[model samples]
Target: MKLFNFHTHNKSENYGIINIYPEENILFGKKYSCGLHPWHYSENYETALSQIELLAKEEKIIAVGETGFDPKSPVNIDMQSKIFVKHIEISEKYNLPLIIHCVKHYNELVKIKSQLKPENIWILHGFNGKIDIAKKLVEQGLYFSLSENILKDIKKADSLLEIIPTDTIFFETDDKDYNIETIYKFVAEKYSMTLSDLVKYIEINLKIMGI
Candidate 1:
């Protein structure tokens, strides 16, 4: 079975949404999620948004983001949010899922979701947050993409997985230098499910999101 990576940074990946920043050159013939990350936010953001919107027209561009709030970023929270909302607009227009990168902003993320009520799917990538926050986001209809951090803390992964429904869950390698199968293997063992079964579950989730 081909293991699906929900989000990743490696441009050479054959089967996943490879994240592309607005300033980067697009490598043709690969699935991608493009956005202007908060870390790269700048005064010329309007130009960047124009570039992102243009890229959104490509058939290979499957999603919008890796864009969201980062309290520690040099950019202020308000500007970060403004840029995120623009990405949301692109996602809505393109009819694609949104892959989010959030840090210490679950409350604000939830608030925006409630306020906008976007019809497209919103996925939180590389999630390693509190279970309560995960549950809260799930309540707001947001999905999650987990990475290698789950392997580092089995006990926490067990608790977090129990609360997050299978249909709302995804596995990714992100920027980490590890095999995606490792994440799949860990979850399969944790839930006492065969790897194939877990794969099927995630595939179903992807379909439900219209990916």
Candidate 2:
């Protein structure tokens, strides 16, 4: 069974290598969620934002960002929110699902989202929060893209797989050390699903989410 890689930072031939070059998709054999990371936030956000817009317009750029608020770090929270809203606006404008990397700032995310009321789908990558928070996000109609660590609780995983609507679910391996296919295989096994079927399922979800 093949897998759909929803988000990755690796260089790729499909999506141009982000920040490294433009007009070249030289890194072959992988799909991508190429975008600016929030931690790499810059003062020249508007300039970088323009470049990001152009990059996102590329055919291989399947997702808008690894962008979102990070509250704990030293960066000014106001500045972070401003930059993050830009990514959200781009995702909304382009009709692409956002690949979010949120840290300690879900409430602020909630506020920004309320004001924007984006039609574009928002996905939380590498999600491993508690069940209540997961439920809250699900209630908000957000998708949670799971990873290897989320598989430890067999019962919880099974429950989530069974109860969560298929269109709101996804999987990824942002992990550079492990191959994505292997990660897919592991998750697929947990769900008692074929890997190719899983990929198909996610693609269907992407469509439902307007990606």
Candidate 3:
């Protein structure tokens, strides 16, 4: 079976979707997730955001983000929150699941999520936070997307996998050079499931999220 890499900037060697920033070079006929990242905040943000609103309607776009909080970034937190909310609005308008990029601001993000109570699914990509935080986020109906960074600490990865419900979790290559198959192999070993079972589990998530 082909591996499902729910998020990544690079093209999939196996069957999976790629994330394309609106400003990046575009190609035809490939699956893509489109949004304005918080890291891209600038004076001309309104202009960029207007463009995203248009791109969100494009047929090739499957999801609506990599956009969310990043408190440690040089970008103003308030601006990030504003733009992130706009992305959420766009996601809702288009009925696309959101792929988030949070960093050291889970609480703030959770607060906004609580206030918005959005119907569309929200996915926190590259999650490596404390288990308690993960539990809280999961409680709020947010799904977690794991990337190759988890492999840097096998024990932690095992523990996180233990806590995270298999059904709400997803694996990705993100922007890393690692292949999605490697992530699948490691996760299957951690869960003591066959590679095919892991694939089936993620496929179920994709279906649930309407990806």
Candidate 4:
């Protein structure tokens, strides 16, 4: 099965993306998760907004984020929520999963989801929460995009993979050096499934996104 990086931040200016000016040549076969990155929001936030909208329309962009609230970041929570809502709307409008970047604000996220009740798929990338917290999000029908940090606690993490409904789970390398192929191999080994089977399962989820 093929592996996918559902939320990569690497974008190049040659691609006409804003805020980020890639310093080096982008690697082959690397699609990305492009967004405003809340920390960089400033007088220039509008620039990122316009470009992101255009990117959302592009078929090459598989997801609408790495975009969401970050409580620890100095950016206003209210503003963050507003921008996030726009992303959620666009993701729904364009039929893309939201590659989320929540930090210290899961409660607010729960509140926001309750209010908006969005239809788009939301994958909380780079997740490292407890089983109860993970269960809570899954119960709300949210998918967690597991990364290396969470994988370190394999016993607890593997238990999550078991409990989360097969379709409601995904894995990522996040920004780590490890690639999705390696992550898939590990997960495939744990699940006693071939790597290709795992890839096919995720490809189905990607098709689910396209639909």
Give residue 141's error in model 1 in angstroms.
1.0
Residues 138-166, candidate 2, lDDT per residue (tens digit)? 77778877776566776676666554566
Model 4 global lDDT (CA atoms, 0 to 1): 0.68
How does candidate 2 score on lDDT?
Answer: 0.68
lDDT of 1 by residue, 1-211 (tens): 8999989889898887799888787677778888877778875689988888888876557888989988766777777878889899999998988999999988879888999999999999999998888889889988999998877888889998888888889999999869889999988888789999999999899888777
Best candidate according to lDDT: 1
RMSD of each: 1.3, 3.6, 1.6, 4.2
The residue-level lDDT of candidate 2 at 17 comes to 17
Candidate 4 at 209: error in angstroms?
A: 1.0
Which structure among the candidates has the greatest TM-score? Answer: 1
Cα lDDT of model 4 by residue, 1-211, tens digit: 3356655443432221112221223344445556666665554466666666676676546567777778665668887887778778878777777777888788888888888888888888878877777788887888877766756788986877776665765776555556566666777788888888877777787678662
Clashes of 4: 2
Q: Report, for every candidate in turn, its global Cα lDDT versus the true structure.
A: 0.87, 0.68, 0.83, 0.68
Error of 2 at 144 (Å): 1.8
Candidate 3 regions with alpha-carbon error over 4 angstroms: 12-14
